[model samples]
Target: MTVDVDFHHGDTIDAVFPEADVRVQVGFAAPYAAAVNYGSDPHWPPLTPMVRWTNKLGWENYDLQEADSEDALWQKVDNRRAAGDPLPGAYHLAAHIAENGTKPMLYASDAFIEASQRGEKWLEGRGYDAETPVVEIARDFANWSLELANDNLVSRVSAASDGNLQRSAFPAKVIAK
Candidate 1:
Protein backbone atom coordinates (compact mmCIF):
# COMPACT_ATOMS: atom_id res chain seq x y z
CA MET A 1 0.00 0.00 0.00
CA THR A 2 2.85 2.37 0.81
CA VAL A 3 6.54 2.35 -0.01
CA ASP A 4 8.85 4.25 2.28
CA VAL A 5 11.05 6.90 0.70
CA ASP A 6 14.07 7.82 2.79
CA PHE A 7 14.16 11.19 1.18
CA HIS A 8 15.11 14.75 2.02
CA HIS A 9 15.47 18.03 0.16
CA GLY A 10 15.78 21.66 1.30
CA ASP A 11 13.43 24.60 0.54
CA THR A 12 12.70 22.77 -2.70
CA ILE A 13 14.45 20.41 -4.99
CA ASP A 14 16.43 22.59 -7.35
CA ALA A 15 18.52 21.81 -10.43
CA VAL A 16 20.98 19.53 -8.60
CA PHE A 17 19.56 16.14 -7.56
CA PRO A 18 20.42 12.47 -7.08
CA GLU A 19 22.50 12.47 -3.92
CA ALA A 20 23.45 8.84 -3.41
CA ASP A 21 20.66 6.86 -1.83
CA VAL A 22 22.29 3.49 -1.38
CA ARG A 23 18.93 2.06 -0.42
CA VAL A 24 16.38 3.19 -2.99
CA GLN A 25 12.65 2.92 -2.36
CA VAL A 26 9.25 4.46 -3.09
CA GLY A 27 6.20 5.99 -1.31
CA PHE A 28 4.62 9.43 -1.21
CA ALA A 29 4.35 11.75 1.80
CA ALA A 30 1.29 13.79 0.91
CA PRO A 31 -2.02 12.88 -0.67
CA TYR A 32 -1.89 15.76 -3.13
CA ALA A 33 1.54 14.73 -4.33
CA ALA A 34 0.37 11.21 -5.07
CA ALA A 35 -2.87 12.42 -6.58
CA VAL A 36 -1.00 14.69 -8.95
CA ASN A 37 1.03 11.75 -10.19
CA TYR A 38 -1.24 8.67 -9.94
CA GLY A 39 -4.65 9.90 -8.76
CA SER A 40 -6.17 9.18 -5.36
CA ASP A 41 -9.12 7.85 -3.39
CA PRO A 42 -11.84 10.17 -2.14
CA HIS A 43 -10.76 12.26 0.86
CA TRP A 44 -11.55 15.62 2.39
CA PRO A 45 -8.52 17.85 2.50
CA PRO A 46 -8.09 20.44 5.22
CA LEU A 47 -8.79 23.96 3.93
CA THR A 48 -5.96 25.48 5.95
CA PRO A 49 -3.22 24.85 3.42
CA MET A 50 -5.25 26.37 0.64
CA VAL A 51 -5.87 29.48 2.72
CA ARG A 52 -2.20 29.74 3.55
CA TRP A 53 -1.34 29.56 -0.13
CA THR A 54 -3.64 32.44 -0.88
CA ASN A 55 -2.21 34.52 1.92
CA LYS A 56 1.38 33.96 0.84
CA LEU A 57 1.31 34.26 -2.96
CA GLY A 58 -2.11 35.65 -3.78
CA TRP A 59 -0.89 39.24 -4.10
CA GLU A 60 2.00 38.72 -6.47
CA ASN A 61 1.95 40.53 -9.81
CA TYR A 62 0.70 38.42 -12.67
CA ASP A 63 1.48 38.86 -16.35
CA LEU A 64 -2.24 39.13 -17.12
CA GLN A 65 -4.36 42.03 -15.98
CA GLU A 66 -7.49 41.64 -13.92
CA ALA A 67 -10.64 43.67 -13.12
CA ASP A 68 -9.23 47.09 -12.12
CA SER A 69 -5.77 46.83 -10.58
CA GLU A 70 -3.59 44.84 -8.19
CA ASP A 71 -5.78 46.02 -5.31
CA ALA A 72 -8.81 44.68 -7.10
CA LEU A 73 -7.09 41.35 -7.64
CA TRP A 74 -6.17 41.10 -3.98
CA GLN A 75 -9.70 42.01 -3.00
CA LYS A 76 -11.05 39.37 -5.33
CA VAL A 77 -8.65 36.82 -3.88
CA ASP A 78 -9.65 37.82 -0.34
CA ASN A 79 -13.30 37.25 -1.14
CA ARG A 80 -12.58 33.58 -1.79
CA ARG A 81 -10.25 33.00 1.15
CA ALA A 82 -12.88 30.87 2.86
CA ALA A 83 -12.93 28.43 -0.07
CA GLY A 84 -9.39 29.20 -1.19
CA ASP A 85 -10.09 28.77 -4.89
CA PRO A 86 -7.27 30.43 -6.79
CA LEU A 87 -7.84 32.81 -9.66
CA PRO A 88 -5.90 31.81 -12.73
CA GLY A 89 -4.10 34.36 -14.88
CA ALA A 90 -6.03 37.05 -16.71
CA TYR A 91 -8.27 37.46 -13.66
CA HIS A 92 -9.88 34.11 -14.32
CA LEU A 93 -10.65 31.82 -11.42
CA ALA A 94 -9.56 28.26 -11.84
CA ALA A 95 -12.44 25.84 -11.59
CA HIS A 96 -12.95 24.87 -8.00
CA ILE A 97 -11.61 21.36 -7.39
CA ALA A 98 -14.65 20.74 -5.18
CA GLU A 99 -14.66 18.68 -1.99
CA ASN A 100 -13.86 15.48 -3.83
CA GLY A 101 -10.26 14.35 -4.11
CA THR A 102 -8.26 15.62 -7.05
CA LYS A 103 -8.06 13.55 -10.20
CA PRO A 104 -4.71 12.32 -11.41
CA MET A 105 -2.99 14.84 -13.65
CA LEU A 106 -2.40 13.17 -16.98
CA TYR A 107 -0.45 16.12 -18.30
CA ALA A 108 2.07 15.95 -15.48
CA SER A 109 2.40 12.20 -15.91
CA ASP A 110 2.89 12.59 -19.62
CA ALA A 111 5.49 15.27 -19.09
CA PHE A 112 7.22 13.18 -16.44
CA ILE A 113 7.35 10.14 -18.70
CA GLU A 114 8.69 12.21 -21.53
CA ALA A 115 11.36 13.53 -19.18
CA SER A 116 12.29 9.95 -18.24
CA GLN A 117 12.87 9.04 -21.86
CA ARG A 118 15.23 11.96 -22.15
CA GLY A 119 17.16 10.73 -19.11
CA GLU A 120 17.49 7.26 -20.58
CA LYS A 121 18.95 8.69 -23.73
CA TRP A 122 21.73 10.33 -21.76
CA LEU A 123 22.33 7.65 -19.11
CA GLU A 124 22.99 5.22 -21.93
CA GLY A 125 26.62 4.04 -22.11
CA ARG A 126 27.38 6.04 -18.97
CA GLY A 127 27.36 2.81 -16.95
CA TYR A 128 26.43 4.78 -13.86
CA ASP A 129 24.90 2.50 -11.24
CA ALA A 130 25.10 3.62 -7.65
CA GLU A 131 23.95 0.34 -6.09
CA THR A 132 20.30 0.95 -6.81
CA PRO A 133 18.52 -2.04 -5.27
CA VAL A 134 15.07 -1.12 -6.55
CA VAL A 135 16.19 -0.16 -10.02
CA GLU A 136 14.51 -3.15 -11.62
CA ILE A 137 11.22 -2.52 -9.83
CA ALA A 138 11.07 1.30 -10.10
CA ARG A 139 13.53 2.06 -12.85
CA ASP A 140 11.30 4.58 -14.55
CA PHE A 141 10.61 6.41 -11.30
CA ALA A 142 14.24 6.45 -10.34
CA ASN A 143 15.42 7.46 -13.76
CA TRP A 144 12.80 10.06 -14.52
CA SER A 145 12.28 11.63 -11.08
CA LEU A 146 15.59 10.99 -9.42
CA GLU A 147 17.84 11.15 -12.43
CA LEU A 148 16.22 13.85 -14.55
CA ALA A 149 13.25 16.22 -14.33
CA ASN A 150 15.01 19.52 -14.93
CA ASP A 151 14.11 22.14 -17.48
CA ASN A 152 14.63 21.41 -21.17
CA LEU A 153 18.22 22.59 -20.94
CA VAL A 154 18.22 22.01 -17.18
CA SER A 155 17.44 19.39 -14.51
CA ARG A 156 13.90 19.54 -13.15
CA VAL A 157 13.01 20.50 -9.57
CA SER A 158 11.53 17.57 -7.66
CA ALA A 159 10.76 18.34 -4.00
CA ALA A 160 7.48 19.84 -2.88
CA SER A 161 7.48 22.80 -0.50
CA ASP A 162 5.05 23.23 2.36
CA GLY A 163 4.54 26.79 1.09
CA ASN A 164 3.16 28.79 4.03
CA LEU A 165 2.43 25.51 5.74
CA GLN A 166 5.98 25.98 7.09
CA ARG A 167 6.81 22.32 7.61
CA SER A 168 9.64 20.63 5.75
CA ALA A 169 11.34 17.27 5.92
CA PHE A 170 13.82 16.59 8.70
CA PRO A 171 16.16 13.73 9.51
CA ALA A 172 14.58 10.91 11.44
CA LYS A 173 14.54 7.13 11.69
CA VAL A 174 11.71 4.86 12.77
CA ILE A 175 12.38 3.60 16.25
CA ALA A 176 9.99 0.72 15.89
CA LYS A 177 9.88 -1.33 12.70
Candidate 2:
Protein backbone atom coordinates (compact mmCIF):
# COMPACT_ATOMS: atom_id res chain seq x y z
CA MET A 1 0.00 0.00 0.00
CA THR A 2 1.32 3.39 -0.93
CA VAL A 3 0.54 6.37 1.30
CA ASP A 4 0.56 10.00 0.23
CA VAL A 5 -0.18 13.27 2.02
CA ASP A 6 -1.33 16.37 0.25
CA PHE A 7 -1.59 19.82 1.80
CA HIS A 8 -3.86 22.58 0.62
CA HIS A 9 -6.46 25.05 1.84
CA GLY A 10 -9.19 22.79 3.18
CA ASP A 11 -10.24 20.49 5.98
CA THR A 12 -9.40 16.77 5.98
CA ILE A 13 -9.32 13.94 8.48
CA ASP A 14 -6.66 11.46 9.54
CA ALA A 15 -7.07 7.76 10.20
CA VAL A 16 -5.76 4.33 9.24
CA PHE A 17 -7.36 1.29 7.67
CA PRO A 18 -6.82 -1.73 5.45
CA GLU A 19 -8.72 -2.40 2.25
CA ALA A 20 -8.51 -4.72 -0.72
CA ASP A 21 -4.82 -4.23 -1.37
CA VAL A 22 -3.32 -1.91 1.22
CA ARG A 23 -3.64 0.17 4.34
CA VAL A 24 -3.92 3.96 4.09
CA GLN A 25 -4.94 7.10 5.92
CA VAL A 26 -5.35 10.87 5.48
CA GLY A 27 -4.63 13.75 7.83
CA PHE A 28 -4.07 17.51 8.07
CA ALA A 29 -1.39 19.94 9.13
CA ALA A 30 -1.25 23.51 10.36
CA PRO A 31 -2.52 25.96 7.78
CA TYR A 32 0.40 26.59 5.43
CA ALA A 33 0.93 29.86 3.66
CA ALA A 34 2.51 29.49 0.29
CA ALA A 35 5.58 31.67 -0.07
CA VAL A 36 4.76 34.86 -1.89
CA ASN A 37 7.94 34.72 -3.99
CA TYR A 38 10.16 31.91 -5.13
CA GLY A 39 13.68 33.04 -4.31
CA SER A 40 12.62 33.81 -0.78
CA ASP A 41 9.88 31.27 -0.53
CA PRO A 42 10.55 28.70 2.13
CA HIS A 43 11.90 25.53 0.67
CA TRP A 44 8.81 23.98 -0.79
CA PRO A 45 7.48 22.63 2.42
CA PRO A 46 8.36 19.02 2.98
CA LEU A 47 5.72 16.41 2.42
CA THR A 48 3.78 15.71 5.61
CA PRO A 49 5.62 13.50 8.08
CA MET A 50 3.04 10.84 7.46
CA VAL A 51 3.79 10.89 3.77
CA ARG A 52 7.50 10.86 4.39
CA TRP A 53 7.20 7.92 6.70
CA THR A 54 4.99 6.19 4.22
CA ASN A 55 7.53 6.80 1.49
CA LYS A 56 10.20 5.39 3.73
CA LEU A 57 8.11 2.28 3.92
CA GLY A 58 8.10 2.23 0.11
CA TRP A 59 5.02 4.27 -0.69
CA GLU A 60 5.82 6.53 -3.60
CA ASN A 61 4.16 9.38 -5.49
CA TYR A 62 1.78 10.00 -2.63
CA ASP A 63 2.22 13.70 -3.24
CA LEU A 64 1.20 14.85 -6.64
CA GLN A 65 3.21 17.67 -8.11
CA GLU A 66 1.78 20.87 -9.53
CA ALA A 67 4.07 22.83 -11.81
CA ASP A 68 2.39 26.19 -11.65
CA SER A 69 4.16 29.45 -10.93
CA GLU A 70 4.41 30.37 -7.28
CA ASP A 71 2.15 33.34 -7.73
CA ALA A 72 -0.41 31.38 -9.62
CA LEU A 73 -0.34 28.55 -7.15
CA TRP A 74 -0.75 30.84 -4.18
CA GLN A 75 -3.55 32.66 -5.94
CA LYS A 76 -5.41 29.42 -6.46
CA VAL A 77 -4.86 28.42 -2.88
CA ASP A 78 -6.19 31.74 -1.67
CA ASN A 79 -9.22 31.59 -3.90
CA ARG A 80 -10.08 28.09 -2.79
CA ARG A 81 -9.64 28.93 0.86
CA ALA A 82 -11.75 32.06 0.54
CA ALA A 83 -14.40 30.34 -1.51
CA GLY A 84 -14.36 27.28 0.73
CA ASP A 85 -13.75 24.99 -2.20
CA PRO A 86 -13.19 21.32 -1.68
CA LEU A 87 -9.53 20.44 -1.73
CA PRO A 88 -8.62 20.71 -5.38
CA GLY A 89 -6.60 17.53 -5.17
CA ALA A 90 -9.58 15.66 -3.83
CA TYR A 91 -11.73 17.12 -6.53
CA HIS A 92 -9.28 16.01 -9.16
CA LEU A 93 -9.10 12.55 -7.65
CA ALA A 94 -12.86 12.36 -7.60
CA ALA A 95 -13.02 13.41 -11.19
CA HIS A 96 -10.46 10.81 -12.14
CA ILE A 97 -12.55 8.16 -10.46
CA ALA A 98 -15.72 9.40 -12.15
CA GLU A 99 -14.28 9.56 -15.62
CA ASN A 100 -12.70 6.16 -15.35
CA GLY A 101 -15.38 4.61 -13.17
CA THR A 102 -12.69 3.24 -10.96
CA LYS A 103 -12.60 3.29 -7.23
CA PRO A 104 -9.32 3.72 -5.34
CA MET A 105 -8.90 2.76 -1.75
CA LEU A 106 -8.91 5.84 0.46
CA TYR A 107 -8.28 6.19 4.14
CA ALA A 108 -8.60 9.29 6.24
CA SER A 109 -8.18 10.14 9.88
CA ASP A 110 -10.78 11.66 12.17
CA ALA A 111 -9.10 15.01 11.75
CA PHE A 112 -9.58 14.78 8.03
CA ILE A 113 -13.23 13.90 8.53
CA GLU A 114 -13.68 16.88 10.79
CA ALA A 115 -12.11 19.09 8.19
CA SER A 116 -14.38 17.74 5.48
CA GLN A 117 -17.37 18.26 7.75
CA ARG A 118 -16.34 21.81 8.35
CA GLY A 119 -15.95 22.40 4.66
CA GLU A 120 -19.38 20.84 4.06
CA LYS A 121 -20.92 23.08 6.68
CA TRP A 122 -19.37 26.08 5.08
CA LEU A 123 -20.77 25.05 1.73
CA GLU A 124 -24.17 24.45 3.29
CA GLY A 125 -24.13 27.89 4.82
CA ARG A 126 -23.46 29.32 1.40
CA GLY A 127 -26.27 27.23 -0.09
CA TYR A 128 -23.77 25.33 -2.22
CA ASP A 129 -24.32 21.95 -0.64
CA ALA A 130 -27.30 20.86 -2.64
CA GLU A 131 -26.96 17.58 -4.45
CA THR A 132 -26.71 18.07 -8.15
CA PRO A 133 -26.75 15.68 -11.05
CA VAL A 134 -23.36 16.99 -12.07
CA VAL A 135 -22.12 16.10 -8.66
CA GLU A 136 -23.51 12.63 -9.17
CA ILE A 137 -21.63 12.40 -12.39
CA ALA A 138 -18.49 13.74 -10.81
CA ARG A 139 -18.80 11.37 -7.89
CA ASP A 140 -19.68 8.37 -9.98
CA PHE A 141 -16.04 7.38 -9.98
CA ALA A 142 -16.45 6.53 -6.34
CA ASN A 143 -18.76 3.74 -7.43
CA TRP A 144 -16.23 2.14 -9.75
CA SER A 145 -16.01 -0.80 -7.32
CA LEU A 146 -12.86 -0.37 -5.26
CA GLU A 147 -12.62 -1.49 -1.67
CA LEU A 148 -12.97 1.05 1.16
CA ALA A 149 -11.20 0.78 4.49
CA ASN A 150 -12.03 3.24 7.23
CA ASP A 151 -10.85 3.95 10.81
CA ASN A 152 -11.62 0.59 12.32
CA LEU A 153 -8.77 -1.20 10.57
CA VAL A 154 -11.14 -4.11 9.97
CA SER A 155 -9.97 -4.31 6.38
CA ARG A 156 -13.15 -4.08 4.37
CA VAL A 157 -12.03 -5.46 1.05
CA SER A 158 -13.79 -5.02 -2.28
CA ALA A 159 -12.96 -5.34 -5.94
CA ALA A 160 -12.98 -2.71 -8.62
CA SER A 161 -13.26 -3.82 -12.17
CA ASP A 162 -11.71 -0.63 -13.44
CA GLY A 163 -9.37 0.54 -10.71
CA ASN A 164 -6.61 -0.85 -8.65
CA LEU A 165 -4.97 0.48 -5.50
CA GLN A 166 -1.48 1.75 -6.08
CA ARG A 167 0.70 -0.39 -3.90
CA SER A 168 3.13 1.20 -1.41
CA ALA A 169 4.12 0.84 2.21
CA PHE A 170 4.37 3.15 5.23
CA PRO A 171 6.71 3.23 8.17
CA ALA A 172 5.22 2.02 11.42
CA LYS A 173 3.46 5.03 13.04
CA VAL A 174 4.02 7.84 10.59
CA ILE A 175 1.83 10.41 12.34
CA ALA A 176 0.33 11.02 15.74
CA LYS A 177 -3.26 12.04 16.26
Candidate 3:
Protein backbone atom coordinates (compact mmCIF):
# COMPACT_ATOMS: atom_id res chain seq x y z
CA MET A 1 0.00 0.00 0.00
CA THR A 2 1.08 3.58 -0.68
CA VAL A 3 0.68 6.52 1.66
CA ASP A 4 -0.05 10.11 0.81
CA VAL A 5 0.29 13.13 3.03
CA ASP A 6 -2.08 16.00 2.44
CA PHE A 7 -1.14 19.58 3.23
CA HIS A 8 -3.38 22.57 3.32
CA HIS A 9 -2.46 26.15 2.73
CA GLY A 10 -0.39 27.67 5.56
CA ASP A 11 0.01 24.21 7.07
CA THR A 12 3.44 22.68 6.91
CA ILE A 13 2.70 18.93 6.86
CA ASP A 14 6.29 17.95 6.32
CA ALA A 15 7.19 19.29 9.72
CA VAL A 16 4.54 17.25 11.49
CA PHE A 17 4.63 13.89 9.63
CA PRO A 18 7.54 11.55 9.84
CA GLU A 19 9.61 11.27 6.67
CA ALA A 20 10.42 7.63 7.10
CA ASP A 21 8.54 6.88 3.91
CA VAL A 22 10.09 9.07 1.25
CA ARG A 23 8.33 7.01 -1.36
CA VAL A 24 5.04 8.14 0.12
CA GLN A 25 3.28 10.65 -2.08
CA VAL A 26 2.70 14.27 -1.04
CA GLY A 27 -0.01 16.60 -2.33
CA PHE A 28 -1.48 20.02 -1.57
CA ALA A 29 -5.07 21.23 -1.72
CA ALA A 30 -7.09 24.40 -1.10
CA PRO A 31 -7.40 27.66 -2.96
CA TYR A 32 -4.79 30.33 -3.57
CA ALA A 33 -5.11 33.45 -5.64
CA ALA A 34 -2.76 35.38 -7.88
CA ALA A 35 -3.17 38.91 -9.17
CA VAL A 36 -2.88 39.54 -12.86
CA ASN A 37 -3.98 42.11 -15.43
CA TYR A 38 -5.84 41.12 -18.54
CA GLY A 39 -5.28 42.79 -21.89
CA SER A 40 -5.99 46.54 -21.67
CA ASP A 41 -8.72 45.95 -19.06
CA PRO A 42 -6.25 46.23 -16.19
CA HIS A 43 -8.37 43.64 -14.38
CA TRP A 44 -7.89 39.94 -14.01
CA PRO A 45 -9.92 37.19 -12.44
CA PRO A 46 -8.49 35.82 -9.27
CA LEU A 47 -7.13 32.44 -10.22
CA THR A 48 -6.13 29.76 -7.73
CA PRO A 49 -3.40 27.74 -9.41
CA MET A 50 -3.32 24.67 -7.17
CA VAL A 51 -4.69 22.46 -9.96
CA ARG A 52 -1.96 23.49 -12.32
CA TRP A 53 0.64 22.90 -9.65
CA THR A 54 -0.79 19.45 -9.00
CA ASN A 55 -0.60 18.64 -12.67
CA LYS A 56 2.98 19.81 -12.85
CA LEU A 57 3.94 17.78 -9.80
CA GLY A 58 2.21 14.67 -11.24
CA TRP A 59 -0.17 14.33 -8.34
CA GLU A 60 -2.30 11.23 -8.68
CA ASN A 61 -5.63 12.89 -8.07
CA TYR A 62 -7.25 16.19 -7.06
CA ASP A 63 -10.47 16.95 -5.26
CA LEU A 64 -12.60 19.63 -6.86
CA GLN A 65 -15.57 19.85 -4.48
CA GLU A 66 -14.77 23.50 -3.84
CA ALA A 67 -15.52 24.29 -7.48
CA ASP A 68 -18.79 26.17 -7.85
CA SER A 69 -20.08 24.11 -10.73
CA GLU A 70 -19.56 21.00 -12.81
CA ASP A 71 -18.64 23.15 -15.78
CA ALA A 72 -15.83 24.72 -13.84
CA LEU A 73 -14.57 21.30 -12.84
CA TRP A 74 -14.64 20.09 -16.44
CA GLN A 75 -12.71 23.13 -17.58
CA LYS A 76 -9.80 22.19 -15.36
CA VAL A 77 -9.81 18.52 -16.36
CA ASP A 78 -10.24 19.32 -20.03
CA ASN A 79 -7.48 21.91 -19.93
CA ARG A 80 -5.14 19.43 -18.36
CA ARG A 81 -5.98 16.73 -20.88
CA ALA A 82 -5.56 19.13 -23.76
CA ALA A 83 -2.16 20.04 -22.39
CA GLY A 84 -1.19 16.34 -22.34
CA ASP A 85 -1.05 16.24 -18.57
CA PRO A 86 -1.62 13.51 -16.06
CA LEU A 87 -4.92 13.56 -14.17
CA PRO A 88 -5.38 10.40 -12.17
CA GLY A 89 -8.28 9.28 -10.02
CA ALA A 90 -8.43 7.27 -6.78
CA TYR A 91 -7.60 3.85 -8.25
CA HIS A 92 -5.09 5.32 -10.64
CA LEU A 93 -3.49 7.50 -8.03
CA ALA A 94 -2.79 4.57 -5.73
CA ALA A 95 -1.44 2.54 -8.61
CA HIS A 96 0.83 5.38 -9.67
CA ILE A 97 2.17 5.98 -6.19
CA ALA A 98 2.98 2.34 -5.65
CA GLU A 99 6.53 1.33 -6.51
CA ASN A 100 5.11 -0.96 -9.18
CA GLY A 101 3.33 1.87 -11.02
CA THR A 102 0.10 1.28 -9.13
CA LYS A 103 -2.40 3.98 -8.31
CA PRO A 104 -1.46 6.55 -5.66
CA MET A 105 -4.11 8.26 -3.57
CA LEU A 106 -7.49 9.91 -3.79
CA TYR A 107 -8.46 13.25 -2.28
CA ALA A 108 -12.10 14.11 -1.80
CA SER A 109 -14.78 15.18 0.64
CA ASP A 110 -17.56 13.21 2.30
CA ALA A 111 -20.14 14.93 0.14
CA PHE A 112 -18.48 13.70 -3.02
CA ILE A 113 -18.72 10.07 -2.02
CA GLU A 114 -22.31 10.43 -0.90
CA ALA A 115 -23.17 12.13 -4.12
CA SER A 116 -21.57 9.44 -6.23
CA GLN A 117 -23.30 6.67 -4.36
CA ARG A 118 -26.61 8.39 -4.80
CA GLY A 119 -26.09 8.34 -8.58
CA GLU A 120 -25.52 12.06 -8.85
CA LYS A 121 -23.65 11.11 -12.07
CA TRP A 122 -21.67 14.33 -12.21
CA LEU A 123 -18.34 12.54 -11.89
CA GLU A 124 -19.21 10.02 -14.56
CA GLY A 125 -20.66 12.82 -16.62
CA ARG A 126 -17.27 14.50 -16.45
CA GLY A 127 -15.53 11.39 -17.84
CA TYR A 128 -14.28 10.02 -14.51
CA ASP A 129 -14.49 6.31 -13.90
CA ALA A 130 -17.34 5.79 -11.51
CA GLU A 131 -15.61 2.86 -9.87
CA THR A 132 -12.63 4.82 -8.62
CA PRO A 133 -11.83 4.80 -4.90
CA VAL A 134 -11.77 8.06 -2.96
CA VAL A 135 -10.13 9.36 0.18
CA GLU A 136 -12.67 11.64 1.74
CA ILE A 137 -11.70 14.15 4.43
CA ALA A 138 -13.76 16.58 6.39
CA ARG A 139 -14.05 20.19 5.33
CA ASP A 140 -13.17 21.23 8.89
CA PHE A 141 -10.62 18.46 9.58
CA ALA A 142 -12.56 17.20 12.58
CA ASN A 143 -13.18 13.48 11.91
CA TRP A 144 -11.62 11.27 9.24
CA SER A 145 -12.06 7.65 8.14
CA LEU A 146 -12.24 5.40 5.08
CA GLU A 147 -15.28 3.80 3.48
CA LEU A 148 -16.46 1.78 0.44
CA ALA A 149 -14.68 -1.52 0.36
CA ASN A 150 -15.95 -4.32 -1.90
CA ASP A 151 -13.98 -7.55 -2.17
CA ASN A 152 -11.02 -5.35 -1.37
CA LEU A 153 -11.16 -3.75 -4.79
CA VAL A 154 -11.17 -0.12 -3.56
CA SER A 155 -10.33 1.56 -0.26
CA ARG A 156 -10.78 5.02 1.21
CA VAL A 157 -8.78 6.96 3.78
CA SER A 158 -10.11 9.73 5.92
CA ALA A 159 -8.76 11.79 8.82
CA ALA A 160 -10.42 9.60 11.45
CA SER A 161 -7.36 8.68 13.45
CA ASP A 162 -5.19 10.98 15.50
CA GLY A 163 -2.83 13.10 13.38
CA ASN A 164 -4.88 12.07 10.31
CA LEU A 165 -3.03 8.81 9.87
CA GLN A 166 -4.79 5.89 8.25
CA ARG A 167 -5.97 3.55 11.00
CA SER A 168 -5.93 0.36 8.90
CA ALA A 169 -3.26 -0.74 6.54
CA PHE A 170 -4.21 -1.01 2.89
CA PRO A 171 -4.76 -4.63 1.89
CA ALA A 172 -1.58 -6.21 0.57
CA LYS A 173 -3.24 -7.74 -2.47
CA VAL A 174 -4.49 -4.38 -3.62
CA ILE A 175 -0.97 -3.04 -3.61
CA ALA A 176 0.31 -5.99 -5.63
CA LYS A 177 -2.17 -5.14 -8.32
Rank by TM-score, highest first. 1, 3, 2
Instruction: Give the alpha carbon lDDT tens digit for every residue of 131-167 in model 2.
Output: 3322222122122111221221123221211223232
Candidate that scores best on TM-score: 1
Q: Model 1, which residues run further than 4 Å from truth?
A: 1-24, 38-44, 59-95, 99-104, 125-177
After aligning candidate 2 to the native by TM-score, how far in Å is the CA of 142 from where it should be?
Answer: 46
RMSD, candidate 2, Å: 21.4
The runs of at least 3 residues in candidate 2 whose Cα sits more than 4 Å from the true structure, single-residue gaps closed, are: 1-65, 90-177
- In order, candidate lDDTs are 0.38, 0.30, 0.31
Clashes in predicted model 1: 3
Cα lDDT tens digits for candidate 3, 1-177: 222334333333223332312222311222210111011222222222333333434445454433435467556666777888775342243233332422223333332244346433433344433232222111112121122221121232222212232223232111100
Largest lDDT belongs to which candidate?
Answer: 1
Least accurate 10 contiguous residues by lDDT in model 3: 31-40
Task: List CA RMSD, all candidates.
Answer: 12.6, 21.4, 21.3
Q: Output the lDDT of residue 109, model 1.
A: 47
Model 3 spans with C-alpha error above 4 angstroms: 1-65, 88-156, 159-177
What is the lDDT for 68 in model 3? 31
What TM value does model 2 have? 0.17
